[model samples]
Target: MTEPDGFRRAAMQWLEKRPDSRVDYSWVSSFEYEGSRIPLMDRQRGIRKPAGFEAALAIRTTFTAAGKLPPYVDAIGDDGLQRYKYRGDDPQHPENIALRNAMKMGLPIIWFVGVAPGSYEPIFPVWVVGDDPEALQFALAVDEGQRFLRPDFGLDEDTRRWAEGRTKQRLHQRVFRSQVLLAYNGRCAICKIRHAELLDAAHIVADGRPNGHPVVPNGLSLCKIHHAAFDHQLLGIRPDLTIHIRQDVLEEVDGWMLKGGIQGVHDTRLAILPRNRLEHPDEHRLEERYVEFLAAPVA
Candidate 1:
């Protein structure tokens, strides 16, 4: 009914029309508003408050190394809500003020999380729920389910832990996938398949295992079939980057799909690798996982 409400709804509708993969930096940067162009985020600052808006438009969290939290970590807090740190220690700072205004107005905003260098995953309609001047941060709710949570809300400790763990896992997986896929240029390392929908960011090391972190170095971009094979120990990649198929599976007489798609790639090194050496799969993890593959029981 209100002008600001209309603008916010329009923005959400516009974003909803696009797939998550298409919401890159360029897509986020441009928006047409009232015959004028509005850049949703600042080129330098983490928080964006357009000149004409009473509240902030979007916030960003920059990319950090795997297993490392960014300078401003957006983690689920003790109150069972997401907490976003302020731009700086100043509560009265313009950016902080704008965010506070959004909370007061019940306005929704975008939360751009950096998945790789200069690349981000945009989460929209995150609401600023509570502001803590002492902590110099704001509380956020990503969905309607979280909007009603209060500090005094009696959440069972176990339930809280489960909620937090599940939320963190989903966020971490998304970021990991984005980073891994981007590093490999959206192509499967084993077969060089470039269809993103058919590709998955497979981990060389399981997340809870020793030295397992969801970083790019522990990831490989694999198509659905190869990913399933890797998980089932039907295929493995050595630290030397050589591919191996389980002996039985390799020796089996099978159709073209199994022969060409799986067995045909045996003894070959990864067809694709991250351009940045730092993003390459960790040799130690590869060796560790390869051992598991070798020990896997024959079906």
Candidate 2:
């Protein structure tokens, strides 16, 4: 794909400023560039500059700034894929022009274009080859909540504000997400069934009201139904993390779903306990809310 001019310029400028880190060239020969395989042995001997060096780094930095960079790329492993070795002209080479173009546009080039599907192991960090000044600049700006011009990059002020706001929300989401993930051990606390796509970061205490702290102890890992129920005060968790179904809610048919099956079965079983006990919900807070939940009539 063709890269936007602004992105390309920003990417180039970033690359020009990157520090030259020593690269491992073990996988160099496995790389294919321009429909030809570069010899691994030749790459080890340092015959030439590997292809697409700038592009790979650009993609890495962009994704890292976006907070979507995969965990594997942050650290290298024993696998050949992470070794930073490749041939100069192999078509499958990491340092290819196509890969570089994808990175400049903020696409998932490493996984989408470079790595094979389902290849789950550590991979090299995207910025290992080149410096990513553009990504670093953007991350710093966002972190500081400062406004800056990246006219070439095309991220306008309104867009930047929106992204910055989302990033803040994501920070909150992550704390809750981690608490929930640990409490449920990556499963739904109410369901006991593990499905990543169906899981949610449910606040044990509601968000942004007089009572909400929006912290780890105030969150739970719930499936969609349970999360909604908790949010609407249709359900509550005891200070012990046990499920608490509002008495009046038991009368409705939909309440039956909450009172029976997976939800019902989970009642009183301390919602999947967190491995770290310190992260557990505060008893006083849960007790206070539990009292409120009990006093209110079920809708």
Candidate 3:
């Protein structure tokens, strides 16, 4: 296999060990080769081309302002493909040339999107398919499946809408999950469960609802069981940060799972929360969700 293909395979192997699909800066910067560490990304630049590569191997968007969303839009263009800005003001910059070279060679690279200040969600095997020097950007597609879709034949209107919506939704959920997990120290807010594999970032207000942006304050880190319970209205969190199990669930005469796992936590405040108050769940969104939970009919 070619070097890019080999690198992608290695990245996939590394990602397999990280079920949460989130990586710290350390992981992004480390890929060993012949006992020497080969960083997947540039330590000081957004576009990374390593020592021997003619094409860029990875690109990243950064989240610099604390408690603020990343500035990179990642929005689909008129051609129905996402475009990443070239590094700096000059399109002829060496790093930007590296990205253009990748596009010309049809090489696949990694895209590390910042989910937190120093944390990222990696999208690999991303092909740089188009270089718009006038726009100072390069077109990107996530996988092999999308790499073939060209700007010459843009997506139909309906298809473009669907693609845009789906892409945004998936990216939003990923970033939200990473940020929420980081804020809560990888522990479930309700049960304090620290298993990253079992945790999810539950939304307070459903997506597409008013003020339901996929943001840290609009999310809660919960384990699988509690996430299901929260989604099904079996559990709720009041605006005051108090936990509440549905009356029926609290009264259910089920076995240990229900007794200790769900019921035992009724009326208790959340076991874990972000140290920064700004990262706390939005009280208003919690109130709206809590009201819905209270009105849900018991089975």
Task: Name the candidate that leads on TM-score.
Answer: 1
Q: Could you give candidate 3's per-residue lDDT for residues 153-257 as a string of tens digits?
A: 767887666655655555556767887899899999988989999999999998769878778889999999999999999999999999899988877897999
- Model 3 scores a C-alpha lDDT of 0.80
As for lDDT, the candidate ahead, 1 or 3, is 1
Give the per-residue lDDT digits (tens) of candidate 1, residues 1-299: 12354777777677777666535667766777677677776888988887878888898888886545568766678866778999789999999999999888888898878887677877777888888888778888776656655544667887666545554554567777888998899899998989989999898999757777678999999999999999999998999999999999988997999999999989999999998887888888999999889888988
Structure candidate 1, residue pairs in collision: none
Please write out the lDDT profile of model 2 over residues 1-299, one tens digit for every residue. Answer: 32223433443333334342111234323444344453222222221222433433222211111113333232222111112222243535444443434435443222111121211111121222221333321121112232232323555556655544543353335434643564567777766657866778776556655656545566667788777777677777777667767666655566556547434643666547566665566677788777777777655
Q: Model 1 residue 202 lDDT?
A: 91
Q: How far out, in Å, is residue 9 in model 3?
A: 4.4
lDDT of each: 0.81, 0.44, 0.80
- RMSD, each candidate, Å? 3.2, 13.1, 3.4
Q: State, as a TM-score between 0 and 1, how close model 1 is to the true structure.
A: 0.84
